[model samples]
Target chain A: MTTRVLVAKVGLDGHDRGIKVVARILRDAGMEVVYTGLFQTPEMVAVAAIQEDVDVVGLSMLSGAHLTLAPLVVAALRERGSDIPVVVGGIVPGNDVEDLTAAGVAAIFGPGASAEEIVTAITTLVPQGH
Target chain B: MTDNPYKTWREAFDAAPTRDADFTTLSGIPLEPVYGPEEGEFPGAYPYTRGIHASMYRSKLWTMRMFAGFGTAVDTNARFREIIAAGGTGLSTAFDMPTLLGLDSDDPMSLGEVGRCGVAIDSLADVRDLFAGIDLSRITTSMTINSPAAVMLALFVAQAEERGVKRSALGGTLQNDILKEYQAQKEFVFPPRQSMRLVRDTMAFTAAEMPKWNSISVSGYHIREAGSTAAEELAFTLANGFAYVELAREAGLTIDDVAPRLSFFFNAHIDFFEEIAKYRAARRVWATWTRGHYGAEDPRSWQLRFHTQTAGVSLTAQQPEVNIARTAIEALAGVLGGTQSLHTNSMDEAIALPTARAARIALRTQQVLAYETNVAHVADPLGGSWFVEELTSEVERQAEEILAEILDKGRGSMLEGCIAGIEENWFQGRIADSAYALEKTFNAGRRIVVGVNAFTEGNEEEDLAILRITNADEKKQVERLAAVRQARHAARVEAALATLKRQAADPTINLMPALIDAAKAEATVGEMMGAMVTVFGRHVEVPSL
Candidate 1:
């Protein structure tokens, strides 16, 4: 069994350092990783996820647009009837992590999160062989 | 009574080298148990493992270049004056996305983006307005622009000439590094090879005329901020720089002629000492390579002068105020590491473009360090410090290895290979692995960042107003852009663009003169870019693993 994660950078946040890093780590860890490049609209992110048929949708947001951008991606995924677990990482404030989680983000990794921990979280959330 | 305390300490320290090893690098470079002269020789020498100059900051203070740009030319001009009055010795211009991408404000694609991130300069008129009272002859300026950098530079030259300032007298830099734009920053107009051509042309032009001006600021700021590690940033940036030198030489210019004017821009990230070591290692590596590999004779050409901006990614949207502290530390690292110019991130940067007050505070932070602190009193104050020297050597080694890997892929035509590596998430993979590992440490209570995972705090409202660029400004910009298009002679514009397209097709003809001619005929950025697109074609990034 394999865990598939779609790592997408939504909106105008050109900062992909985190997302790219996570994608590489997941791929190396034997999880399939799909990376959608910069300026990905929410619709684009969801469509890519569905097309790729990934188990987790990881959104990396650095532009303060996360408040507006992250939720839109989650909502778009839901509207598409996709229940794939979602995770987000970037300069997300601690207080907003819970709000993001409540908005259907399964987990949130802020600055300083380890790739292993994120990989572990994704595995736990959608356990391999489940 | 004498239980051999040293032996006991060694036993405890060596208990678990694998799990409990206390290391001091993002890549986990092990710390030496101790350091002697044998570890690293000294400062002001080969490998420059300590400091480049014998007396570093003590001899000259780092240039306080506050990055300023906002709204229209008039608005940005005001900000520039305010910053200079408040002790900014150098000027750094930040153009709006449209300007950066070579679109006039009135273009359809530039509707809402003009003057939002930076200033909007549609023509030489706006450029004149931008530097209205400023003395270009006396003070230096750095333009944070790429893509259509050649046009912007031509406007700058024409504007200076209009004010009776000679091109030779112009002392500044243009972020003419278009390669990095394709690599990290998305604001690119022409394809990679053509962009390199423009850079070479500009280098050729500047080498002949504006000798004091830096033709290219090979930037790793965007790359590092985009998620590269300190070593990746240093290595990739130097590789890009070497590629440019090779390109310039291919264009019939000698290495020594252009190397001196070449500069760099780095992102001073949150890792305090790591950032410092990166800078130190950069200088040594650049000096060694230019002198040894490129056969650069000029000492100035060997020196790696750079500008730095505090890592924008390090700032948090949650506890916005905490960003101030982070910026301060980053700025300190940059200053200590010997940056020629520095821009501290505004506290509210994580939210939006900085307001007037926030920009002031950011400038004042540099001022406080310059005048108020004793950090500037000594040159390379940390020079020969056992830890700093070791870290510097480690970074240099790592960076050199990365550069070798890049060079081995292909030196001159590595753009495709580089992009392929990126698509395969090679660089991104390394950065993510390090970033995640660091985060894991913090989460596991092994590492701690104040006001983050370890520090729980109540909700606190920010006292400052986050400046937002309104849609009305965008509308005005569009209207202004439209008016300019309406006023300019359509026939002349079309003729100039056709001429530009013709010149662009020929490799021998320098594109700068034609680009300037196009700009003079009121050719909008989009039109010029469109013409080039017809000739050069758009770059379709290759999809990889």
Candidate 2:
């Protein structure tokens, strides 16, 4: 099966250039990328990820709310009996990377993460059985 | 023709003393020792193709308004003082995303976002704390708030009242441009027409009451940051400005009375010559439109004064320190283009909120340009350059074409046209398309980003320490909001909000007085904006891309 990824913008941050670019990148990389538009709450994202049945979910946040909001998205998926890992990206500080990983975020892509690296990370998140 | 007055000067320049050094650039393109045809309209004249002022920086340096706000009121207040003490001329406040969207700190939507991107302002109490020690009367402050900018302005006026500062004595700007919100920033709350009402109300209020305050910093900074070309940034900003002028005319304000106080905000992107050309074209377009189209009599009304912020999008995540060089080059472009004020992005802006040390260096970048370098001695110093003049005219032509397209959509009403465009994702579609194309170019290695593509020699690990604003600030901000709510008289707040809602529904009444009354009652930004929301429903964007 082809890799499926759910891309979303959680919370009130509206810097969508990176997310939009990454969405196109994933699509170009031969992956089915479902993008849930802006102002999505964690619950909405989790529900969308589950409904889409994607292999991984990507959250783009630049409002410095990643630490508080990203983990909640991860937990929201688990609460819904879904283990769909959420990948995070944006202006994330270096120190918070580990905390985000420990919170079950599959991967973190900072500002300069190349298209190849992002595609690889999403690809690796896909299970072979899928 | 007429002996070509420049012939003598050209011949003298050709026979001028030649240096032994090669005039060719590193790329091997030969450069003329001197450029000719250095004749054009002077600065401070009609059309303002050169600088808006005759002397430009020779008379007064561009105000350095460093945008620094994060965490609680007290936290941001300290940073404000640091900026002030560091010789920053003006204060520019950056509200948190929640604050920008007009949500209370305790609102569920504002969770994890309070004081994150900027300061968390809830009520007048928070504003009081935010500007506690800062002199409201003497210092000019620019608040980067929109969607709920009228509410923010009301809160500002109420705070100024508390400080016993006369409303007319106030000097500052409100980023009250809402058209770009739908087009780019996406920080909008109410629908377009309703938001225009709020903007018109604020413009009318400032026109009548505050002489020094710029009612709207009609902005293209966010538009360019959202990946618009420099020309698009100029044209969109000017078109929106013209829209506001139309709205003001309908609101019974004279063009001259309102136009002089209407300033602009633009982005100085990394396309150095192109960015400079964009500014020159912007002034020419705005001046021509205000005079020829709007029939403004005052020269100040024709002059376009703008604040330039170095493009934040151009900063790189790889070899973050390299951003300083980019910022310096960009700032030089802004200065050369005759910006009225400037904000240099910090080296670590791509990673996080600027560290104090990093912000100081950014400020120093401006200081170096102003004091150390002699770039400011002449106004519109690059005006006569053959290349610059050509680029300016070309950018203006492109911008004017798009602007005309938008104008036709509203039957010449920019406000209506903007609303129509927002309804159908016209601006959004174009912006998204441009962004996608640029990303493709970068991805395909067609363009070179120093650290990201061409020269990737930096460490994988980012070692630069960044300023962190944790949820502790959120907790404190929420607690403060709660305390403000508890302390203020609830009945007064409700009554003021009711009046505000009543006034919002009425087309004849200006909403600023009611908004100011609500602010006086200690009504929160959410409550005031909530009242407007009740009158004008929320905006659900037409999803483009």
Candidate 3:
């Protein structure tokens, strides 16, 4: 079984280092990755995920706009009838991680997360057959 | 061999191998056992392992450039005055996102972003207002805008002209680095090739007219903040700088003609020694490349003068005040590393655009360092330190290897296809791995960041007032943009824009004159950018990973 992930940057956050790094790690780990460049709208991210048929959508946002952007991407994905899991990593505050989780984010990786852990999380969150 | 005084060095060391936990780089380069003169050379020489100039910060302190912008032009003008009044020696302008993206405030695309991040400038009128009472002759200003940098440059030139300031008398920097916008910032309007053309035009124009002005500030601040490793930041930025120099040369400007005006902007990350080494290595590499590779004879052309910004990524939202400490440490590294100018990040940066109070504190960080601290009393204070010199040499060596790898692929080929390839392979991948590794370390309790995964107690809600631009301010900005558009003569704007479009399509013609004409004719940023975008289509990054 192969894993496909769409790594995206949403909103005005121009920081792509985390997302770009994650995308590369996932690819090297034998998963297909799609990198959505900076300033992506939630709708664009969800559409890209659906069109690419990715297994999971990972969001990397450092800008304070994550409060508005993260939830919108999740909601947009669900509304588009894609039940793919979502993962987020960045400078998100500790208190807000739970908020992101409650918004249907499968997992939240903060500043200190490793690529192996993220790959493991995605592989575990979505079963092979699913 | 076993009976040697060191007990066969490895054998004796192996018996204990006292793992010096304190001696490792963020990238895991181990500290050497010892260093002699042969290990790394002296300061102010090739490889610049120690320092760029013989007397560094002791000769002149780093330029105290506070990043200032907010609300209307008048409001931001007042803030600039406040920063200057508060002992800032240089000025750095932060334009609102709309201006940065070449959109007028009234544009539908600019909704909710006008005057939020920085100041809003619609035309030369706004530029005039921005520098209304400010003297351009005495103090230098750095503008941090890229895509519409040529337009802003025109506006600036016109503003200075209005004040009877000769182009020759003007001094400052324009962050005319559009390539980074594509690679990191995403504020780019035209595609890469056309953006390079605009940069070439600006370089040619400034070289001829405004000799005192730094045409392009080749920036690695955004690249580092975007998550590049220190080595990646150093190599990629120099590569981009080399590309710009090549562009200027292709535009018929001599290497010496433009190299002196080329400045750099770097991010001073939390890795204190590593960041310091990065700066030293940067100057050495830039100087070497300018003199040896580009054959630049002028000493001024060989020097790498940069402005430093404390790493915004190092700041955490949990304990925002802790950022002040982080910024101070980073700023110190920059100062010791010998930056020409510096902009310290605000403590509240992780949460919002810095409030006035936060901005003041940020500025004061530099002030205290400049006056109160004895750190600036001597030049390149750490120039001869064994540890610093060793680290600087190691960084330069590693960075040179990376540069070789980048160039081995052929500079032109790399510029053509390797950019996307590298974005896929090394650039984005390495960033991901580092970010992931750091996260894993935190989660596993190996790495501890205060107020984060570990030492996570005593986090409390504090009553803090954040300065926010109201919807009313946004409304006023939009109205102002609309009024500027309405007031400008329609036919003149059209004709000027048409001329710009025609000139933009030609490789031989410099677009700066046409852009200046358009700016003077009161064509708003979006109108000019939109016109050029028509000639040069919008860039869409093709995802390779």
* Candidate whose DockQ is highest: 2
Candidate 3, DockQ to 2 decimals? 0.23
Highest TM-score scorer: 2
True contacts kept of each: 0.16, 0.69, 0.30
**Total backbone clashes of candidate 3, pairs 3 or more residues apart or in separate chains:** 13
lDDT of 3 by residue, B236-301 (tens): 788778878877878888888888889999999999999998998898898888788888898777
TM-score of chain B of each: 0.87, 0.93, 0.89
Output the better candidate (1/2) by TM-score.
Answer: 2
By DockQ, the candidates rank as 2, 3, 1
Quote the TM-score that chain A achieves in each candidate. Answer: 0.94, 0.98, 0.94
Instruction: Give each model's whole-structure lDDT.
Output: 0.76, 0.87, 0.77
Estimate the lDDT of model 2: 0.87
Instruction: In angstroms, give how far residue B419 of model 2 lies from its true place.
Output: 1.5
Overlapping backbone residue pairs in candidate 1 total: 10
Candidate 3 CAPRI assessment class = acceptable
> Mind giving the per-residue lDDT tens digits that candidate 2 earns over B286-318?
988888888999989999999999999999978
Off by over 4 Å in 2: B1-39
